[model samples]
Target: MDTSRREFLKGTAWMGAVAMAAGCMSRQSAAAGGASGAPMHGFRVAPMKRVRVGFIGVGARGTPAVKRIAQIPGCEVTAISDVNPARLDAVQAWMKERGLPAPKEWSRNGDKDAWKGLCDSDVCDVVYSATPRPLHCPINVYAMAHGKHVLQEVPGAFSLDECWETVEAAEKYRRHCMMLENCTYGEEEMLAFNLIKKGKLGEIVQAEVGYQHDQRSLQYNPRDGVFWRIDRHMKHHGNYYPTHGLVPAGRCLDVNRGDRFEYLVSMETKSASFEAFGQANFPADDWRHNAKMVKGDINTCLLHTAQGKTLSLIHNVCTPRPYDRGNLFMGTKGIYRSYPSLLMAWEEKVGDGGAHKYFDEAKAQKIKEEYRHPFWKVAGEIAKKVGGHGGMDFVMDLRWAYCLQNGLPLDTDVYDLATYSSIVELSERSVNARSSAIDFPDYTRGGWKTAQPFTVDEIDMSKFGFTS
Candidate 1:
């Protein structure tokens, strides 16, 4: 309701394309013929499915997703939509540059409504919503209502009501509504999961992960670059973008699908960064944008799983920190993290500052080798060939199609999205209540216990046709 809050909110329309184009972090397809070297059982992955896709808000985060999806076989981007005519043309131009056909046509609607063509049109069966945080739920509900599946960008919904609303819509529509959270498929994170799963790390008891990017200057990033995160400076806190970091760590720790997030408490530092900027830019009535414009240090939210394990998640955009996630995994046996490098079971002695303290090349090699994912085990060499974020973007796109078409469950499913999102909502509540313990609401309604852990079976690598 305040002016500063409104400042970040106003640009959602203009930057819808830019934000969608950039994507929330980035995702992947493995190459044909699994790579050989390691000695493991037949870890055959299921072939990806072909899901016809339509895209909405192809701007910031959407641009890259469009490009990435196009590269992914089976899934096709049949339609694209955005409110800005210029943006529509821009996306078309990008498509042309990529040698893809131009979309059917451009449908224009006035400013009051989103470009609902792609979502409403029957031309596509699935819609990927890459708009800001606030629109995540609305667009998803719209797509599902129209009998279409939806893959929404993260921080899944802005509020608790929207969360429940999304689950309800999916139930009513009987359509797939998932958060396209890509971090779960990352190489290192998955490696951590494999190591932990094998009991190499012992009874894994606690963890930490986060989105540590610094975006203080995001406010002035051209007309087309504004996004939900910038506006959120004033709305709520707890580095809401925790999904990117947490999803992978959660997989590593088996949160939700295995271990469940029972309760969480959050605390956000004051918005000293936003206040300084407001003082510099606005001389009069800056207080109007006050609360919405800032949160102090970082939005730190901690969660305790139903099994009594604890994990800390940090989400912050205004601070200056290296972009990193997937942190220290401490168990009764050892700890594992990827920022500096990889280490493993008894690879290093405790108190020598952990793995970094006792770095061993042979142990590191074994750690890396032992935990390669099914996708990585088969396509490491090829992923480098058709690379996008270490080939993860490609693998994620293919897996999405593979899961839906074949009727397999996605590794990152609706509950994963909901639970990851709950961390954000609960963090906001925690910060607002003077850092109180905001009990997490089961966004899944009553579906938590029955959810499946995301996995894959024997994939048809013949399609991508592995080389090397």
Candidate 2:
């Protein structure tokens, strides 16, 4: 193995042990009662006229997020940290080009913990991290502990203990900790959410969601030099990337609000597709050919909610196939499915037996326009112009800034982060235990019962000069 791979394995082994110990302690605390800290449901802070933001790991995701946040009216990128100084320089230059002040840099310079300095500094009101998976929890906890709100990449926690740690930290610190689940901000997803809120789907009974993108080339690209994603596939099993689909699905069902996931059962197919891809693409002597891919080619996890709702979550990164999020929602009076295309069917009357067919294209378009989310209605054009992941990234960042600027409770709070991220470890446990059902921790301490459902309130685009 290469030196970096050897060091990564060693570090991963140590982290696994630490995670287990932490998990045991957290469970013990839960058994006694609950976390010592208060719950962060509907938590809000004083409004900031300009929310100063610090960024860590300004690579692919962070770079675009920084640019988008710069365009937002109430956000100021104050600091950026990364191991690569070149990335910092590039971002600084971009800021200069945009006539924005260059952010202070916290480059590695032989210290891998350089990002901690950014979190500790008082320059930023919030810290956003697009770091590797292992660093997500640590950055979140540390940033919140230091009195800065945190915005982290998807699957915020790698293990159950990390999930608990983030929740406790946010609660104890009284700061917003939100997972940057951009998928929830997608135009289609927002439209679906609006329809659900408007009773178009009736009572949602089940949701089918999954991340099924073929990432063989990205994972094993020679030019990229071995991504950490492929390393995850080698080391772990069961839904390593779940939030892309789960967050949007959960939002439709009011997860961690009116309902919470109760238990999960997961199963996986044999691991062969990744290895086969490596063999077919790379040389016989390449590291990919020799690496052992332990994770299954596909993992499907079913979750039961406290309200008796069901969710089907799937994860598959290997195999050559068309990209799909597998977003399908089944309801008592209607159904919405988006894979090959957007499809919906609903009954005009309860049990009238007229909901057997989907709406035609023209009708569907009209309904979509009528029920379009307010955020899209106001900022859709600007979002489309800025553009990232079909403008969802911009919407997500814009909403983050708007909430902070207005002192509104975040659409997705700490509990959502904990509940959604806990799937990574929870699914792994179920898979390793021969598909045995594993109970989900009530990270909200039963607060979900009274939490309000997410709403699609319209923003005044004129305030940001986006519309008149």
User: How many clashing residue pairs appear in each of the predictions shown?
Assistant: 53, 0
lDDT digits (tens) for residues 1-468 of candidate 1: 543223223423213333343401110000111221221111122443556678777766776777766655456778877776776787788778667777654344535254465666777888888876778888878888898878888777766667666656665566677787766667777677777777767778889777776676665243665454566666555656778878777776666655678778887776676556545656466442343464555778888887789988886666556777746688876777776566554433444445335447786777688668777676554444444577665566656665665565555655566667766667766777877876665544334455555443344454331211
Compared with the true structure, what per-residue lDDT tens digits does model 2 show for residues 160-257?
Answer: 88988887788778889999999999998888899998898899999999999999888887333537888888888888899998999999998888
**Can you tell me which runs of candidate 2 are displaced by over 4 Å?**
1-26, 30-35, 108-110, 222-226, 462-468
Our tally of clashes for model 1 stands at 53
Candidate 1 regions with alpha-carbon error over 4 angstroms: 1-50, 97-99, 105-114, 222-227, 277-292, 343-357, 385-387, 445-447, 450-458, 463-468
